[model samples]
Target: MNNSRLISLLGISTLRAAPRDVHLLYLSRFLRTAAFGSTGVILAVFLSGLGHSDVRVGLFMTLTLVGDVFLSLVLTNWADHFGRRRTTILGCSLMITSGLVFAIASNYWILLAAAVLGVISPSGNEIGPFRAVEEGMLACLSANYDMSDIFAWHIVAGTLGVSFGTFSTGWITAIFQKPVGWTEQESYRVIFIVYTIIGIIKLLVALKLSNASEVSRPTVERQQDAEQEEAQPMLQSEETSVAKGPGPTALMRAVRIFVPELTAPTRSILWKLCLLFAIDSFASGMVAFTLLSFYLHSRFQAPMSLLSSLLAIPFIFSAASSLLASPISKRLGLLPTMALTHLPSAILLGFLPLAPTIELACVLLILRAALSTMDQGPRAVFLSQVVRPEERTKVMGVVNTIKTLSQSAGPTVTGSMAQAGNFGAVFVIGGVLKAGYDLALVGLWLSRRALAEHDDIVLPNVNDNLAENEGESDGTSRV
Candidate 1:
């Protein structure tokens, strides 16, 4: 009984209740994000070391994201039809291939082509459909579990992965450059080689997933049924034009497939979420770790060891802070929790550039990290609770799609500013913009609070829900 309580406190009982495949998915994400952590730390400076200008580096980041947006859509749209496990393997394969090319290729065009054609993370976060597919698989494989715990631990795993990846790359590169006397390019290439090895391991993990991870016939049938049901009203409507009366033309059918079938009210809220998240993402992109690391390298001439170690500090905060998301949201409600925690982070980000020393800057960054990701688990849980189960994935996908689109422009703009010798302004503007977004989100929540609804649920009965969930998934083995 004591062990049972301890396990529950730790999280989706840290996968105690999860199926073997769910555990595999978490492992896959950890390895993949760690690889992202490795490359994201060096992506910008590596390009600059290759003699590319800041503008070129920024443009490269932007174009890579632009390509990724399309790649994500195509692969995710076909993920189920193509097979989830197979799709996962394909992502890993791309990771390996991309790493190998980045490790060896020097020509800017060749590197760009490799980045666009395969999996390369510009922001050191996920840039592909791997997240969505894996989340879906997790949902299916662990149908009875409380995803809040699962996702909380999920964020922890990814952040920890980043922490490891960044620390490893920083020290490894520093060792190669200072001790072994390697060139900057050589050290960076070694990091990519390490990334490739991780990718290979991730592929092996993906292969271990059972057939249960694939989309079932019932799920496919339900989707098709939902699609047809959604179109029925449109087809029957007098306003919707068809090739003929009542019947939807092939073109109309094709176009409608891209639309989500949600209630009008949910659609309105989701749109609001899209705008909020898109703005936040844009602000975030402007100060991406890749760019920030580059800034430190250029401005302070900080060693790779310092950059990696200092940057890794925040991921530690982020990982620890992620554990607090579920509990905080349960108390403050999702919107309040998101807005309150994020506002401080944004304020800290704004002040980051004002720091006269690297030590001070790291202090602000560490503080920001403590609050920045506390929203991730809650935001995901918000999506799950705000809409029907069927709508959850689609809504999350839509928000991510818009957020990525908005973020794609940020690096280029920031690069341009850096090239123009206005690097500090980037953070100021991003911080201001992010703060405004948080205020606007809070306003939205307050406006909805006049009447009792989901927002008010936290005030009255959130603890009850938390207790219920705890009782339901105790994770204790029975005798």
Candidate 2:
């Protein structure tokens, strides 16, 4: 095809390939993340203003993570049975309640209760069940499109939303404090009110999702019929014997109903991925953007407005990196792309505490941000590709839940250390641990690839399924 015609065709194909639900999902992620980003920037500052010490601040953050871990585990594991839209709306409602409590409540115990029982993002990132279910839905909906590109755009949307929220909160607080004659505490409360409004909007958007967003469940009868049809001649007698044996017990049937049955290889890969991810998440908790903001304020006595602008820089770089992730993954492969980009960022984090001036620290932070999140898109795509279709939600839920559990420990320890005047140690510890995770990930990927090659096992290509689906559709040309 000629160059002009080829370019036009590609544009049309891309537009046609994206479903309405995927676009809505992106919009919902942006709105929800904006709320999280804004609250995360101010959560620690607001709590400390309420006369709580640094240890209490850290304890609150840890409890918030524990609540999220529990809720996410239950909601995501049964999302297929309960319906994704319903679970997502329920999560949004919890966020709304959390926001309201933060906006109005002043009692320390009351706020702590709200933090522990309600959905909130103390890490300035996804902390509820929304991500696990949404990722599974996006993977299913984008099966016929460019999976990497779709995943890249999703992260880009979230990063940009977070950037806007972080930057705006600082300015908003400043404005409210000066012209509006509000105290710093009151100004922060206004931000939480905005968070509540955003949650309401997200809830409405989630409600608009179509029935196509529901998870696909396979029935036992259909599985049995397919197995019978595919049985080989030599295996027919064995299959019949098994089928004729006593039916599964009540406990086994319940297990099958709620839990997905993954093949042995898929299960093994899922467990390894979860372990690696938990290590990274635990490190992340030590320097969660929320706690990091608190650290900057307490250690350097930086102003909130300045801190807000500095924090936003990383999200901007992360957004740009997210857009570039698809092409990078295409060139470098998923595992390599994840490892190469992440290692440098972790090394940069190790140097953050050594900067003598705020300006130098901000510069290092921006550079780290540019490289840190480049793995997000590729990692999501890798997980989606490794598991069976029906197992996607379950696997994503399990991984996310375990990661949250691992991360919950970091804040308590870091908080106590910071309270004890060991402010610089957390960054060094987090950076070193993350760097170790990156190295181990690379080793695992190499070993797995070698074993697959040695055994002559062919892995499925993500794009091959898209091409096959296109061919099966009506004879319209595809790019």
Candidate 3:
């Protein structure tokens, strides 16, 4: 074919092959993340403005993260069973409710309750069950496409939303507070109002997603195939004749559905992944975006508007790096890509506290942001590949829960340190811990790869033995 025709065919193929649900999920992520980014940048400052102490602000952030952990664990465990589309809609609804409560309520107790029960973002990232469930659904729908590429675009969408929201919140507050004669608190509340409106739009988009977005459970046909395979015994003739027992009680069955049943190999890999992710998340919590915003204000007496603008720089670079993830992972492989890209960012974080000036610190942070998130897409793809298809929801849920739980400790610690006049220590310690996590992750990945290779070799030998036994049984029947 001519070059023109060939190029046209490739373009059409790329666009047409991606499922509609994938696009809708991208939009949902963008809208939700935009809301998160806006609130995340100002949450700590907003609380402080309301006469809350730094410790209280930190505690609020911690509780918000902890709440997400619990809710995500419950919702994501049953996401497949409950329907991905429906669960996502529900999550969005919670987000809208959280925004409304934050916007209208001045009672500290009521605000805390809203934060705990509803979807709220303190990390300038995904805050509830949406990410895990959406990722699981994307993996299902994008089975026929380049999964890494799709995930990269998904990250890009989220990061862009965050960038825009972070940048706009500063201006939004400035616009409302100055010319419009709104109170500082009221200015911040305006962002939450926009957050609620975005949530409504996201919910509408989520509703448009088709049922094909749901996780594919094993059908009766698949069950029958499994039964036939089990019945074809090589040497265990008596085993096939055993009558099937009665089904488990309904209560027991319900419990079983919530618990993930993975093979030994898959479980081991999952555990290793969870441990590494927890370590990284804990480090991340120490300098979560909200706390970071607070730190800048307290340490440098930086204006809220400047802090917001500076924070947006890193997100822009992070979004750009996300676009490179797919091509880089294609060449370097998933594990190496994640380790190489993430280690540099962690090391850069170590330099953040040492910067001589605010400008230098911003540059360091922007650089860190560029490299830090390059692992996200690869990590998501890796997890999807490592587990059985049926267990993706459970695995993602468990992993995210562990990560969130680990992260919940960070804000509290950092907040206390800030109150104690030890803000530098928080950055130094978090950087050290994150660097350690990067090294450990590489080691774990190598070990898992070695184990997988060993299993690959051992499986064939066992299969050979089973085949020989079957031949012997055939000969005996002929005799």
Specify the highest-lDDT model's number: 2
TM-score of 3: 0.86
lDDT of each: 0.78, 0.80, 0.79
Mark the regions of model 2 whose C-alpha exceeds 4 Å error after superposition.
1-16, 217-263, 459-479
Cα-lDDT of candidate 3: 0.79
- Encode model 3's per-residue lDDT on 1-479: one tens digit a residue: 89765533323344356888888888889888888899999998889989998788888889988988888988887777778888888898898899999999988888888988898888988878888988888777776676777788889889999988999999999999889999889999999899999999999999899978875555223423443454345223444334433323333445544454444556766777788889899999999988887777777887778888988989999998887877777777787888889998988888787887778889999999999999998888877765555566777888889899999999999888988998888988888999898898788667756776876522111001112111221111000
Q: What C-alpha RMSD separates each model from the true structure? A: 5.5, 6.0, 8.1
Candidate 2 accuracy as lDDT: 0.80
Q: List the residue pairs that clash in candidate 2.
A: none
Worst 10 residues of 3 by lDDT: 470-479
Residues 127-231, candidate 1: write the lDDT tens digits: 876887776665455446666677787788889998899999988998899899998889899999999999999999999999877756655556668667766
Candidate 2 residue 315 C-alpha distance from true site, Å: 0.5
lDDT of 2 at 179: 90
